[model samples]
Target: MASYKLYYFDGRGAAELARLVFKQAGVDFEDIRYTGEEWPQHKSEMPLGAMPVLEMDGRKICQSLAIARYLAKEFGLFGSNNMEAFLIDELFEIFAEIMNSHLVKIYYEKDEDKKAEIAETFKKDSAAKYLNLIEKRLKENTSGSGFYVGSEVTVGDLLLYNSMYGHRKWLGKFGVDVYEGRPLLEEHFKLVGALPNIKKWAEERPETAF
Candidate 1:
């Protein structure tokens, strides 16, 4: 087996979803965390000048979603079929949009007035636009109670786990009940969160706002 090393800051940011996938897959990898003071010295060495980078036996891959997707495929977590893989990948893409368009937008907006405006409507905007779409997808799934893609957990589920559960506090800051009015979403979150590996990892993982 090849060695894996994941480099990211010492927080449950982009890297956490990959970590959750690793936990679910029972794959062992080196988690290389960097502090704020330590990042600058190594930033120039990164493939895209950012993390979280996954190095497989020294060959590196950048971007957290890519890394997680690769690992999930290797670990039989992407899906059992090509169409399933597409569904899973598309779900993950939706989350990337939510993270970039709404979640991160609130924090990165330098103008306080704009930031306040974003916070005021963040929950409704995000729910109506993104969460509603996800809810519809959930309704399409078998029973609307199982994992997003198939009978088991997928990389997409990990991304969903991260977006809402991992960052629940941040969303809650704006009174975003991501699970509200979306019973399927709530059940899925609860089911995924209760998976043995995920539950154990969540119980023992470090506490972080995001």
Candidate 2:
């Protein structure tokens, strides 16, 4: 029952991982959003001048992954042991890096041609370097439950699901589908997306161009 406020642009971006965790944990938090026009005015107030800062009991924290890790610990979503937590973080960072690779280009590149080119390369590189590795990793999880870390859903799972869901929704414009063709990833994506809390949040959460 701590006072929590999450600030982000009006979209399902970085803050969404924590938001989904909150929903899964069944916690109430203020989801403060800003628009492009309003962001600059309040930009100076954000820690690191970045959005997706999580303020808990008036203490502000920045960086999406850090906030996510903290929340995972807070909500018992980190995993049951140190080893579990390690696996969870490992999977989370891998998924985060993959998502960020394309996200930076999609958000910052001004040239449509360049962006398209980047997307093509991203699709190719991701498949070659990551998609198979992740499938093999998922196959190694003891649960064999299509989860990234353990038997129960963890923060890593949410991050993975969010990456795929967002990629499918946001990256399709560039003709890139990060979650395509990998059978285990597809099943993992489906399993996490269909979780009760996540499904509900997806149904009701604000729509964003991202």
Candidate 3:
């Protein structure tokens, strides 16, 4: 059993998926959270000047997706085979693209009108397009068991779950509801949230604005 320490801001923003993976795998790790004021003091110590960083036995790993991939492979969440791994990677990339393009703007934009415009576009366009595709993928899987790859829950499922959870929780403040008219996606969200480990982790997790 390797020792793990995760460094991230006091919010779920990008670190939540990795946390979910750890919980699902029954792994123990030190979750080090920082506030905005505390982050600058610790930022210089991070390898990439950003988080969420995963320290394994003192070796630092930067980037959220990279950490998620490492945990996935280490804990048997990658998939059952090579093709499944590839599919999971592809799905993860797609989710990242969506987050970068639409979701992130709402957080950084200062102008109220511009932020509103971006949020609406995200809800009407990006969320609709990508989430429906994800829903179709879930429905097409062998077991239709709500896992993203093969018949088991892969890192892809965790990624999608976190993305949807963020959109609902964070974007909901802007009156953006991505699940509107998407029954499959709504059901998928509920299913992921209902998983025993994830549900327990979520219940006990610290609250943050993001």
Q: What's the count of clashing pairs in each model shown?
A: 0, 0, 0
Query: Each model's TM-score, in the order given?
Result: 0.91, 0.93, 0.94
Index of the highest-lDDT prediction:
3
State how far residue 117 of model 3 sits from its true place (Å).
Answer: 1.4
lDDT of 3 by residue, 92-117 (tens): 87888877877678779998778878
Off by over 4 Å in 2: 99-103
Pitting candidate 2 against candidate 3, the one with the higher TM-score is: 3
Write model 1 residue lDDT over 89-192, tens digit each, in one string: 88887877777777688788888667667766766555577777787777777844478876777887887877777556665665556556777777888888
Where model 3 places Cα greater than 4 Å from the true spot, the runs are none
Q: Rank the candidate models, highest TM-score first.
A: 3, 2, 1
Query: Which residue pairs show backbone clashes in model 1?
Result: none
User: Model 1 Cα RMSD, Å?
Assistant: 1.9
Best by TM-score: 3
What lDDT does the true structure give each of the candidates? 0.81, 0.83, 0.85
Write down the RMSD of all candidates, one decimal each.
1.9, 1.6, 1.4
Per-residue CA lDDT of model 2 for 66-133, tens digit only, reads 88889889989988888889877777767767767656776799988788788878887664577677
